[model samples]
Target: MKNYIFCLLAIVLFSCSPKEQVQTFMTYNLRYNNPNDGENRWEVRKENVADLILNYQPDVFGTQEGLNDQITWLDSVLTNYSYIGVGRDDGKQKGEYCAIFYKTAKYNVIKQSTFWLSKTPEEISVGWDAALERICTYFLLENKETKQRFYVFNAHFDHVGNIARLNSSKLIFSKITEHNPENYPCVLMGDLNLLPETDPILYLSMQMDDSKGLAGESVSGAEGTFNGFKHDKTVTDRIDYIFISKGDAKVKEYKVIDDQVEERYPSDHLPVLVEMEL
Candidate 1:
């Protein structure tokens, strides 16, 4: 009788314990909707981009350099996902967006906002020698199944301004610390426009763990994330990244997807995908 009771209690305890949830995340740069891109124009590559995303179906993803119309088209096509972001130009639908998208059925958004990577984060202005206005979009999300809450920050740093990139890194770190006072799990992903060895990345590495280094043997695909629409296999300038708060999550796999259709690449930059347990 005591054995039976013990077995029943074990079963109950096992059933009641919280289970670890695994989620897939991706960071992609769509290269904006420039008509001068010719065969690589947004209209020409939109379907391929959708197909790639649908094939992987990441639980969450961040995109950079997408115009309002481009974002609208993606929002329409990715029916199961919802996104949060604002244009860098006007805090409205004016310029490029650094948008974050999550699966609507799996997570409920608690709070979301967008802020410029500038001296005046609350206003629409450029900062620190940046060539153009930059922005970061963040979302606090609650997983419906486990009731676990986490934050996701998606950003785009200045490609031309070294000082801007460094300051932007500091600002983003501060913002992350400010928003997550309870030390909830955080994921930061984007097209930072800087290499892995740069000072900005080094600063971010002080507190965050780059998913690529954590994946170990599970890393796959190209070593770099930017293809520049060139078929050269020798390109290895990795500028995109997925970073998670230290010890917050365990990375299961990391991949830099270089999928191309008929020898034509989808975009100028490839997508960085990470699978993690949180």
Candidate 2:
């Protein structure tokens, strides 16, 4: 029976198409420490992240909960990748920042932009959120060899504002799908802060495919992500996520790696990775 099960697993694994061109991607919330630090530090949590990035080496990475300094630290360590220019924290580029990193050797830079999630979220501005200002940064990229133009938008929704999160989810759909209805593929990833059943996530899923959670593994249930700092094994919520474009793209392999090694657990929230094909 054991031999039979092993044979079954091998057959299943080999049956899947080996799309060599499929890209490996990661999304994380780098944990900019705003609550415990007095010196305005985003690098307080740097060491933990640096180690993880070196291990994953994702072709494209989208990050939320990153400040300018944190981004700088990452930029310094990962020499092969370039960011989407200088990104903004919200509609206005301000105190906080979110960004997309691409492995220059793996893909070519095509286009990039950052937008806010407020009534007036400029690329640079410290707006008043119920808790904090939120922003979404996007990059339109192409494989140097395949020449496929796909988009990646990374964002952080307001932690305290339900209405804002709901509205911002709507904005993403409009700017991405409604505006480019002629088949512009997009990948949306971020620390959305809402569960699958919540209004915000539900609204966004209407336009984009939720690559990490809602499609295959648990088409109807939540896959826990945000594991607390002390009791690392206890998981109760699904906040962080990875999403793919509306057309042609489908998540092939998806996983949430949860293990305590050198303080890297895919980022306070498990770093979700997905392989998608065109």
Q: List candidate 2 segments past 4 Å from native.
A: 1-20, 34-45, 85-94, 121-129, 178-182, 213-222, 262-266
Model 2 TM-score is: 0.80
C-alpha local distance difference test of each model: 0.92, 0.70
Candidate 2, 258: how far from true, in Å?
1.3
Candidate 2 local lDDT, residue 91? 38
In the range 1-278, model 1's lDDT, one tens digit per residue, is: 99999999999998887653789999999999999998899999999999999999999999999999999999999999989898999899999999998999999999999989999998999989999999999999999989999999999999999999999999999999998998999999999999999999999998799999899899998888888888656559899999999998888999999888988778999999999997
Model 2, global lDDT:
0.70
TM-scores for all candidates?
Answer: 0.95, 0.80
**Cα lDDT for residue 206, model 2?**
72
Candidate number achieving the greatest TM-score relative to the actual structure: 1
Q: After superposition, how far is residue 224 of candidate 1 from its true place, in Å?
A: 0.5
Q: Write the per-residue lDDT of candidate 2 for residues 218-249, one digit (tens) a residue.
A: 33222577764533366768888887766657
